[model samples]
Target: MSLSIGLVVHASRRGVFEEAVEPVSGVSLKWVTYGHERDIRPHVQSLVDGHALDGLLVGAVPYRACRDVLPRTLPVAVTRNSALDLALALGQAQARGWQAVPVSIDTFDHEVVCEVTESLHLDRTRVTCLPYADDQSVDEICAFHRRSLHDGDGYVITARTAVLRQSRGDLRVLNGSPTPSSIRSELRELLLRIRSERAGAAGFAAGVFCVSRHGCPGDPERSRMDLLHLLRATPELTDAWIENRGRRGVVVLGRRTLFERLSRDWLVAPVLDRAQESLNVPVSAGFGVGSSARTSVVLAERAAVRAESENRPCGYLMEDSGLVLGPIGPGGLGGPGGPGGRSAGQWTGPPTARPHREQGDRMRELARTVGLSPATLSRLAAIEHDVAGRAVTPSELADAMAVTDPSGRRLVRKLHAHGLVTSEGWAQTHRKGRPTGLYRLAIVAALTGSADGHALETV
Candidate 1:
């Protein structure tokens, strides 16, 4: 008289996933990938082919795979821990700094919704709401709306595949296997393009990180490759001499799918490929989907979870790497990889390689839980990453998150109150002959927790 759930599956597909469920138990692993589309596609294809499931647990084996897989939705969850993940980006865009659209479900108060829209600077005319038949329909409904919205302008889509498949490969090659040679090529092309566009802009321009820049941290050649790729694509994106608002603005030309997966997957599979035969280490990544900082965060949480769970010290697989295998699935990784780990799966979510990380390597170690639309924790992460990063002081963070900003003292207070950010002192600079207080990153490592900030700790 009770139902069960099966968190993972081998090649045998005819088992009752519900049979594996234990009531009042831990979360179920839905879709886990071993970095190869071949290792994962069939199980996950059902998700995109209109098959219905109670929940979706998406994992990316690599950037290219995620790019191929997430052409639209799968908005992405930044963390597996439910409490810590805040679904910051279901539809807000300004917070993430990318263009986006929100899918309204007819539940929000019209005024509150409008305020959110205006604050995000989203087009008032482009907003929409629909009815959801159980949570399963959320994916279907969002997919439809995305099609209706037309697939041209910048958008924050859900579904890991949306993020994975959405990017056109020009974005991939630059960061593809990031080597010095690749960087040079990407830079050459990117410069030509930039010069053709905004030929005379003096200040720094926004740069975007497509698949190449998604998780290039551990691979310098790859990072250089990605940087040059982005530079080739958007040449005006130079490291500027003058800082904007006392901060540097770098647009990592990231793809929505990679962004979505990176949000959750970075922590799982930090390494996507090898560079000169050496393994990449615990690299960091970010995910941004939809149109808001919240959604971007939602994507980040999802990527982080996948990254943490799947990544290992030596080049490894989600199944073979001695990782504390959660219920997520993907079969064993097909094999070890060469430079950049190219595969349909890597293009979708291929297996990855990593070097090392001490026990304290991770910046965030959110508990592994469930729920894509993280309720609270995701919000806090967004605050620290998106809003708080903008603040000169604590009060600015509060104001940025669109919460209570009474005295503009919320940055340090909120972070300290919640345990996310720490502050130094104000410094003076000569811009307009006026001195100013400048704050630097004290301890703003991304952590998971509640609005109250008790759970967050330096990972």
Candidate 2:
């Protein structure tokens, strides 16, 4: 099936995206254009409500304006101005007899500006860059340019069209917008991610839903039947093949996609709440995906055993790839930490049992030194362990910690302040915007007393 992708762009930049996407097989584009950032939310919301989108493509402005409305499951790519775009803009400025030095640039990262200026042999100290922030208003950006120009900045460069309009033709402004190639690259990548997810969703899946045996007043068989009836009545499971498993369990066979929807991408499962309420007993569920039905069933049984061991109404998912996610019941999609807490669904390898007394004391000491809770320090240590000394961006850290992007950035900054992490470099994970800053976590080293001799690093 051809994937349906929604393209959200400013009216001025609509042609750029349209021209770049051109025509591609197995993909259909739906354009949603807006004249201003404020108009983006309504248009994007309408697009999402009116059509079933396989993915979405948007620039940073549109993305920032409507990010809250974007469906969590839908794949989205946010295009931003790249270093190449800035270099091109600088080339244009030079052609127009403008000096590259003593220039004010907006929306690009400080590192990118320095890299471009240093490479071109321009004085880096003469360049003023205001990095993009989601909460920054266009007025604030325009004010920055105005102040720079007033203070002897020779020219102004910006990625935002609104900033240009507000310039009122008085400022020597150069548009450093993303080129067509950048948009096309992001579009193609988003398509690839969507297709990959769809293909993986078709894999075989088996689920075991067990009624807890402790603290229940009814016959085990009756409770099992009640659980079975609940599964049978679930509208989302209508297509699945469900049957009795063991003495107090029900087994369900279905596609991975069906289970993903029920569990909200393994974040939480609301059906467990319904089962517990209906059967008047704790209900635990385990879902597994594998190469074959038997393999999936065995994994599901093992996951169910883990969930049952919790002795509460909770759920877990086990994939043949050795990823485990769990404690997903009645938590309102917050996973283990419940909204802003450490995300329980994040797979940081096999669950680490609680640390021994000596290890716990060391962790507590490190936490005290860093002014963070021991529990938070332990989670960071686990993430560090999983990455095995590899660098990660704030977005990746946020995903692993199950927090918002802004929160992840803040956590990184805090860790950087306390010497628990060191800036490695910048990475262009996406085709647009500024390259994300990457950092290597030293929490493990700090906890194990290995960072005593090294000087704290900075980006």
Candidate 3:
């Protein structure tokens, strides 16, 4: 779609502006004329709502006039009585042989007038600057211009359209306006920012890690707790959880920016190495990327299993396209047993070996532990794959999981009791309505002696 741009111009100067510039090539312009610069904000906002403008170009509006009223989120460009514009007005005076004539300028500091005079090699005493405070009115500005014309030379310049309307004969008025080039530059920058933000918001990634604590024979429980803390402390992992009774590993969700860091080997490998070094454990983590949360977590589980079977301190990445890559090992292993031994970065074997449980048995066990129906847990597991590590409102959960809102709320509360999720806070949608509660998923439910688990809770 072509960018929609709104222009707020003084009603008197609109004609001159229309004559100077034709329609911009790639944008649709919606113009709103205002009697005063300070009053332009409401009209500009109206244009924004009416036309859905992507950017705004405010003409001859002083920075002081609209700074408080302008929308902070929208890309806004305002015309000011800048230093260059002061030079333009001075040049006009010099052109008319008004070098000896006393010049009057509105909305300019006396210091600036002195600088302009110095640059023009004119006597500073011959120039008069009238700087108006935010409280000054258009009538007061016109009165200053009128007095200057009557008491001194007629050469005058102003930013206010009120003074321009009163100009006649030798009382020349030059409206301090932003050049076409400046407006174009601002628009270009705004478009660049918009494009960058859209690209970042395209998609996000989530990974479920199944860690085997076999290598750490010394205080394995402490190591497991430390691993959990490490996962939570890392800034890159948006959300992290142990997801099981025995703390097999953590499930991590990352936004697009963090996923990009993972692609660069800056996030994942360093984290794995840190966990290995800190916990004195050989870490095997699986990472997956998919369009939905369920797909990503499932793929990540497969990768973790692959890493475990290989007995290496490595990571496997499963792409959304179902392509599996690598028993990719960490770069360095400076753990308890040195680089060459099993404790360095390689898993020797499971310390306390137990009989493996099948998926059906694991599900039944998890359902019993959480005190929820197997079918409900199964439904939750299916929904977990699609969560993508996001916090959800009751309505959002209902829509995504194909349940009633009340049912979703009840299910989440049950999962909370099982230590799978927690209440984050409330988000207010409107001023008059009740606030919606936000819940973050804390853990997934994994059955004893099995890698198989169900999605528990989500933010």
Task: Please tell me which predicted candidate would have the highest lDDT against the true structure.
Answer: 2
Q: After superposing candidate 2, which stretches have Cα over 4 Å from the reference?
A: 68-73, 118-121, 151-153, 207-254, 257-286, 290-315, 320-323, 328-459
Instruction: Give the per-residue lDDT of model 1 (tens digit) for 395-449.
Output: 4544654656432332333233222444354434545432222343323243312
Q: Tens digit of lDDT per residue, candidate 2, span 70-116?
A: 87556777676666889999999999998777888998765467667
Winner on TM-score between 1 and 3 is 3
Deviation of model 1 at 395, angstroms: 2.9
lDDT of 3 by residue, 97-188 (tens): 76545767887544345445666677655566676455667678777777766765557777666666766444766765545554555455
Residue ranges of candidate 1 with Cα displaced over 4 Å? 1-332, 336-391, 407-411, 417-419, 426-459
Pairs in clash, predicted candidate 3:
293-385, 293-386, 294-385, 294-386, 390-459, 391-459, 392-459, 441-457, 441-458, 441-459
- Candidate 3 weakest lDDT stretch, 10 residues: 348-357
Question: Against the true structure, whose TM-score is highest?
Answer: 2
lDDT of each: 0.31, 0.74, 0.57
